[model samples]
Target chain A: MSATRVTTPVQSVDAQAEWELAYRSSKLRDCEFTTLSGTPLKPLYGPDDAPIDPARDLGLPGAFPYTRGVHPTMYRGRLWTMRQFAGFGSAKQTNERFKFLLEHGQTGLSTAFDFPTLMGYDSDHEYARGEVGQVGVAISSLEDMQTLFDGIPLGEVSTSMTINGPAPILLAFYIACGERQGVSPKDLRGTVQNDILKEYQAQHAWLVPVEPALRMITDVMGHCAKHVPQWNTISISGYHIREAGSTAAQELAFTLANGMEYVRRGQAAGLDVDQFGPRLSFFFDSHLDFFEEVAKFRAARRIWARKMRDVFGAKDPRSWMLRFHTQTAGVSLTAQQPENNIVRTAFEALAAVLGGTQSLHTNSMDETLALPTEKAVKIALRTQQVIAEEIEVAHVADPLAGSYFVEAQTNRLEQEAETYFKEIEKRGGVVAATEAGWIQREIHRSAVQYQRALEQGTKRVVGVNCYQEDEGKGPQIEILRIDPNVEREQHARLTALKKRRDAAKAKKALDDVRDACSGKDNLLERFIAAAHADCTLGEIADVLRERFGKYKEPRIL
Target chain B: MNDQKIRVLVAKPGLDGHDRGAKTVASVLRDHGMEVIYTGLHQTPEMIAEAAQQEDVDVVGLSILSGAHMSLFPRVRDELVKRGLGDVLLIGGGIIPGDDVTKLESQGFAKLFGPGTNTEEIAKYVIAEMARRRAATGGRR
Candidate 1:
């Protein structure tokens, strides 16, 4: 055997020496030169930084191990769905907002339910009294869901609902809404954030226990496979985890881990991997670090594609694609200098686009103050338009493919995520790890570290730690204020609906839901029947909550 | 000898599931030598008031980001007042507008912190307010 040695090129060595000499003589900012996740950065990246294999790591777009992109033509074929996550006040008001966005060129619809609906509580429930229509629209029954999509044709438009704990019930209501619009389940297209695992790990919006929630998610997957083929049963989300203070790699690892766990559960439930896997989607957060966010998205695709094909033994190329929706990080928005959020959101959205997202939501600048007003939402939507039309970023796919820095960061993220996967496996997979509060503690540790860094000025959030200004004297921007009467009106409407509906039929539907929850019958079918029978979301959820008790998050420090 | 710590009951007293702020504040309070009791999600005003009374917390911090402060905060305050624990130093935080802050303050809240509020400021304010209350009550109740 012959021994081989590698050495740096003479010219490259001389360039490195000159670079070190210049670095020693020049002044640099006295701050950590690292990514938000603490990945160290050098002054420059040469070929030595990352050795990329063109045929292996950097494969062609739309091919197996899709690191570059999921689609071949990418944006040139079709721009990402510009979905603005808008919901607030009553269903009527939010419906008006939805129409407004659609009129202004929103390509998709994303609904954000109020806390009551998210927690599977009726608007008139005592626990939901004050919070009827605060954060998002309060949809207690199919009536509210119907009002939420009043004039908009559900068949023509794609919708995404960001509800986890009550995801099945919400999706049922949505399917019922579609039926009212003369849209069959087969033609309907949308996604439900049925990613319950993340709720226990980060969001804390979970309703049922872990085992029951998994059962419900698998039930949805099976039902959608047979019924709503185009519908994404679960949008495996990292957005909430990122908002909860996880680093970029942590978000990627935890999100993909949850996705794989779902795949495993589906397989365990005797469902073919290809049937359900193709419809599974992902949701990610685009934060301030531009290159890091882009690299994270790239790494996510490569990892998912490889895992789905190589590990899961999936033959379908569609199942290997990591289709994701990106939202600009809400945690990155600042209240100190509220207008600065506009710039932050623009860069973040651009990163998502450059990272090859299938859809994107640019957060409104005034979200830190309150729910976005019409004007603020218009600007947020216009940010995407500017990126698509003015910026012309969609002219080519994977523009940053060969950049040494981006590739190195992508490799680093992939490696870090693999390490986390191993650690999570050691802790007995995602569900067990989540139940034992390990995942939450890991996220909390990063969150605390990041908060400490921000407090100590090590992390320079513009207009937060560094660019100080008196917010009391800043330009007063108009903020959206939900009318206090929205709650009263929604409660009254719910009462009126209850009076008009068939009480006995609703009771029977809820009983059937309980039966389905107890037995092996598909819960989605029962939920759909309940939605049709005018049983409120809280009713269906309560029936299941009775059988499978509510989850109390373990106290993790 | 019993250990002395500033006991705080950090509760989310509404339907809002956004707990990033609440968890961060709880951690900060705990780090600053305060014993934080975080009653997880979906706590009603009655539940919060009962927990505060039972835990005997020196401070009650309600985190409401769902724009229901006008309705929820007053209910919590009324519950605490009805329970004869009005001196529990009720404070609030979340995506609250300035106008609502004034309204909540007039309704017996100590102060309302908004987004981007420093944890140190919150910690310092709690300590200072507790000391002031202690001084006013002659170090009793």
Candidate 2:
């Protein structure tokens, strides 16, 4: 050891100097806080930051351990579908919006059924009253389905229906409508949000108990796996979980737990993972945290991949690839300074894109105020376009690849989510947690925390809390106001459709649904047959509810 | 004067299904001493009123956000009058339009609060309004 002690020139720069140069005039920055799930984020990250195995964790895209992106050339080959979720009033009105969106260069379609249809009420039913078409399209029967897809070629467009509980009935009607259009069930390419676990956890839209609801979900999964192989049977959604004020990590943990439960149910039904798992997809909410949302998606992909491969023994790569659809977080939209929502949406949309989403729906600026108007919706869609075409974001895959902050966050999120997964498993998985209201309590705790933060000004929402303007508030953004007359029109259509359909045939089909639901027979097949016979959604639901009995949530506060 | 019971109808108007706040509010209100009639989830305005009338409530609270509250709340207000229950105070909450708050109030909405509103204020408002209504109606007959 020659004690050379050669004094080398000061290496490059000190940490503070580098930070100042990198972040621009940063004082000795304050200590950064950990994520909600206690994931520490360093003030910086670099190539050697992530504690991930190169061969095991950072696998190539379209291969095992997909970290770069899901597909080889995600946007270079084809952009994610720009599916604007539009529906209100009646099927006729929603059909018009669908046609309009298509004419405006929208690729895929998403239908938002109203509460009545979601809860399985026909428009003519007494429970429907003011809710028939307030939130989304009203589908009382197969006739409404026909009208919804009228003029819009169902064979050409892939439609995603955001309905659960009654998802099977709606899917049945969709298949029947497609049959009338000269299309076979095997040719249909679309998705049904048949995930009921999230409903129990975050949304509370359960129409039946856990066992029966799972039965209905398995029915859809088995039917789609066998018949409509091109369709995604379920979209395990974390969007509502996040929207319900859950942290990004909670959304990931809870959603994956729900997805795993569904997979277990599907496997219990004797479907091979390779056969049914490929059709399993996900839906997520891209929130305001740019890097956090991106990391959430990456962490989600890794989690799902590992679970499918190691836990579920899914051999097929396609089964491991967690294909997901993302929507900008609606809760992140601000009612104050609404235009700021446009910027927020742009960043959220970018996060989704960079997160390797297969499909995305950006919320319009005015969504916080009302249903997005046509102008605002166009702008929202254009936000995605500008990012894809103008911003050159689509050119590179995982643009934030190897970034210090993102990598650390990704690792942290993965760890936190793994812990949550274990806890859920210990709690007897999703069903047990939901039944015991554990998941719900967790969501409530997180929501209360987030709300308290907003109330206490710990988190600054630009126009909502900070920078409050008293007079001459920002430009009044035009909100989409659904015409009230549409209700009367839909009611009239319901009356006419009820009068015109074959009463005896409808009654018989409903009887079949009831009989199938009451027994162990696959309700999907029976529901499909009933849909062909023009049995309205309400009629079918009435029969199922009469047998299944609705879920009365235990008082859990 | 005797303490008047604060009547509240927690409802979900649109397709959004997060009812933790609604249920939590109902429980807290009950604990804070209010007669809360939770309409459960996915309740339309008609169901809300049917519950309101059947329960003989004094105030109706609407929790909606799926961007349908603008059209949905007005319809609820009109139906409340149609059922001859217009005296019931209509309060709107959840993610509502700020400008539309005045519009809804002008259309006979008593109060409007978005997220982050103090639950105590809500409870106190309901109690005070019920007391005022009882006084106005000459001790609820």
Candidate 3:
């Protein structure tokens, strides 16, 4: 009676609109569509559909809140630098591949160190067996580093080393090697996968415990800021996280959270945000969900910009910028119908380009079987080139920016990721969470769910669960064959290098590294000095192991 | 199939950080009612062999993606024999080539599995092989 007496036109209009929409709906196969993160999607999008504040959320490319890209021109000015993850056998062999990739138009160098090198052991060390130059080129000392980049100019080409626990020593080796090549650390431009937190969460290449690892990372940050200003002390990576079976949102959120933690450590170490943040970079995995991957990248830029500005109080625009390298997901590739991997890679690469990655590494078709052959590697490189040249997808910035679905999904994903970040913080940071097995358990639970879905044919992987042919049967794809003798040859080279080096000098250099590790001294500085003394990687590794000791992971399962 | 559990030792022999596959395989094998002893990250050949001997594992499953498979597998094979564990089936997995697999098998490593190898098949093989080995050993355990 009261409503009838005072009924407003607004109330009647609202009721009429609701009734019209409720009656107008027609039956379809499925009424609702959504992203994995539970973001609602409409059937279409237009210029008027986006809910973004242009100046606040997504400014111009290269501006604050760089949702479009970190650079104004982006790929229009230069296509992403194609860097293939290449290494195996000896430094001589990997060095050859380096030249090959460069000659074939690889703009950056990404080094994959063997187990022993990564673990800080020499080729002759008992633990070094089977691993020397098997997974990557073994660089045990300055001699190996020198051989690794022998013909390649360190002064010009930016190099990224996928080493963590011993990243400081490796950086020192590179600096010393650079000195030998008449290059200085100041002029070098590259990254050290010096992200130790992710090491605990995703990759298990950690040498020391979390506390020392954080210190080592900060040491690089301080040293690189002062000396190697052009170098990125750490490449905050989500590649391994995704490869370890994380969803896209987890990868984005966890990686940025790790990046924030690193920044906090750097600040605590007395380094200014502006001093080190400009050099901070990221490495992401471009998964099979093309649009999702693209949305993830755009959302990453928006989230990082907001965090750097509001949370960390970053002043410089460069401090807020997120320049990242994208690598197509290796876990996505199937060993069945190996050639189909090429198509998957192409699509992934296209997503990366559209996502505005600063650089890219497309997974080779044969990598699921073995380290890629030169021909297969070339196809991967060509995949990027074709996307940049032939495909006109990069003409516009955030081409899908205003698309209602993408914009809404991006927001939803960013929100989900933020929730995860809060959860990680509540669990006492990523390292603590990992130590407590919370992070591992979460990943394990998700992995189990995904596998169960696959098993039950709920998730359709084109060639896998459904439409499986012969179920793991196929004509074997051509695998990149490595010579078994490479290990023997690497051993001989290590022996010869040891025989020729000044034993006293090498011993002293290693002693310095051990002293540094035992004390609060910068390990990178001593490592550089050791490299000058021509100490082998194994010698340096042994010294550090004696002082810092190897990490023993707490078993979750 | 009320058989004795298959004791499988899952080992990472090198510094390569990729272990999802290894962990997944271990979990799957355990789900299939096998006892899996995972020697945590960065294990050497000596450690792997010692673990196998201590655990009295029926199978030693080595996962190496860091391309150190050739050096790692052969040395593990040698160590197993050195430790009088020649009875244990030394299997290999992860990014290994066909030709190298042949060479490794010739050198007495058990069968090689690649990227797409089924978790079920791995579990079944380990269970069946362990049963056979137990029969030969007169079921002392």
Candidate 4:
């Protein structure tokens, strides 16, 4: 809704006056011209908007600051990993889906655990009714984990597990699964979404309170730095934070703040930043704002690189690189006229690549209604493949580098994030602010702002708010329905596993885990040993809950 | 018409933590001049029912994103009936399919809003429904 003509039309020259007269007389549609996050944009931009110094702000890719990208060649060297997160039903069913993805040319594996497992509950736990395999694969034991990666090679394929609250337990099961495949932890490459601060602030999944969760993360960091060298111990995520309704700037600010807290924790535990820093990665949501999303990624890199090198005093270049994964915004998809989501996802995927992500996941068309069907998943994957193979935009690094609008947006987001960092520091760090409900309140405020705009018709979402469409016009799309029997079958597996396991050994190892939670010992060793002793995820999490107590969120608006 | 302010309890009745929609609707209903009570995450059916009874709310809205509504909504509904609050409007939302929306609407659900639903619409629906129910019951408490 902003006008860009600064000079008076009457006093301006002939061309300017004529154009201004035409613009004033023409009927412009009533809509707000802004980014997806409500950032106002002018009709046109000039040199005055962006004054970027290339050498200092954005050095050559892989050089100091690393603003442009992490690598010198970028996609010229390798395309971003087309990692569609696929998990539903039991482990065997999810395994078939994984293999099907691999056969269809997916680059990496991204496993999504069901909500029960995400909350550290077994399939048969009382809290897990009707939710065993609804959203993702229901994994309860090492047997389930083993079946998940049955034929997939642990040595070759890199897998990323989206688990946070019980990250150490899941990683232990994964490590033991690899061991059975004759692959030591040294060769296993993947990422575990071990970030817990966002869980407290947004996602609402947690195994323990703030203090114990940070301890578990640092414990996993220490172990993975030595044995699981290739493993990304923590994917400091902004994805869920955004999904929970945050602006792009809040997403970057809160994500990197939590990341800084992790660095502080590792340093407090006497671990070097360079030791665990390179293994630390990030995950973000690519919303519908093309230039703004690209700028956010660039700003994320520059901020993290400067913090790692200057603030943390890490000398390794690897530690300075801020590698990240990106997923198209699930909140952007609509249930009405769902086919339009394919185009939305394609554009968002293009933004991720232009933003220089190491991996990307595109949300399926029908995901607004259910977990994507096979055809929907294929279309989502093909969107990425089309971007990788057919699109020539990736041949250059940070292709939007010098664009006036893009650079200006990048600087704007960076400054806003810095302001937030100071505010977070004023309230303490990420964990303390989260505990005080400051971060949650801030994110929810922006979410409500966006929703208000959408309702007011200022921000138009095609097929949702603006375009008129009848439901009977188009053919009904098939939706994926997880069989209700999956829960029954999962409960049966858990029952059989409990009967088959060595009860005494599991009890003793789980007791060790409980003791380890209280002591100064690293919890991962106990977790791995417990995994070997056939302990279920629920058993170990139950012990941790007993030792660490639980977290109660302070109510906020 | 009775000048009673519509009382509403927004409940997240399952393990999922997606409270954006719940909180947004709660805020919008509050804006529309309704008394609102929000039950935070991880509340069982009995807890929701007790909260509704204690608060004396006219409507109980359940928000669950984990696809547990078939089991959860009925359990909460039965618990409300057990507590003798069966007539309270029981509405909900999540990633529910169109078929499930029809099925649940037929099976004692007031209404089920899905993704992309405007919070204002939810508020208007509650106000109108409460007025209609009160008029039908001859304005009895």
What's the i-RMS of each model?
A: 1.8, 3.8, 2.2, 2.1
lDDT digits (tens) for residues A1-557 of candidate 3: 11121112233668756866875695555323544322455655433344567677668889888988888987778778888888887888899999999999899999988777776777777776666666678787777788889988899999999998889889988998899899877889899899988888888777777887888889888888889999988899999888887788888988998999999998998889999999999999998877789989999999999999899999999999998999998988887777888999999988898889988999998877777889899999999888877878867777877556677667667888999999998988877887887777677666665665556545556666545576333346666655667667767877887789889988887777777876878777877888888777667766766666666687767
Question: How do the residues A1-557 of candidate 1 rate in per-residue lDDT, one tens digit apiece?
Answer: 22111123435678789979999899988899889877779888866676677677868889877899999999999999999998998999999999999999999999988888888989888878777778888999999989999999888999999999999999999999899889999999999999999999888787889999999999999999999999999999999999998999999999999999999999999999999999999999999999999999999999999999999988899999999999999999988878889999999999999999999999998888888988988999999999999987898999998787898899899999999999999999999999999998888889888888889888888888886877672338998877878889987888898899999999999988888877899999999999999999888888888999978778775
> lDDT per prediction?
0.89, 0.80, 0.81, 0.91
Candidate 2 DockQ vs. native: 0.31
Q: Each model's TM-score, in the order given?
A: 0.96, 0.87, 0.89, 0.96
Better candidate number, 2 or 3, judged by TM-score: 3
The regions of model 2 sitting more than 4 angstroms off are A1-40, A46-49, A471-475, B1-16, B20-40, B43-60, B66-90, B95-108, B115-141
For model 2, residues A1-557, the per-residue Cα lDDT tens digits are: 22211123333558657765877555654433545333555666554455556556657777777777789887899999999898887788788888888888899999988877887877666655656676788887788899999987778889999998889999999999999999988899999998888887777665777788899888888888889889999999999988876889999989998998888888998878898999999999998888898999988888899999999999999999999999998888777767888999999999999999999999988765667778888899888889878988887777776666787778778888889988988998778888888887787777766665665666667776789665352247665566677667777877887788888987887787778876878999999989888777877777777787877665455
Per-residue error at A195 for model 1, in Å?
Answer: 0.8
Off by over 4 Å in 1: A1-11, A473-475, B1-4
Q: What's the DockQ for every one of the candidates?
A: 0.68, 0.31, 0.55, 0.63
Top candidate, metric lDDT = 4
Q: How much native contact recovery, as a fraction, does model 3 achieve?
A: 0.70
Residue pairs whose backbone atoms clash in candidate 2:
A45-A404, A122-A538
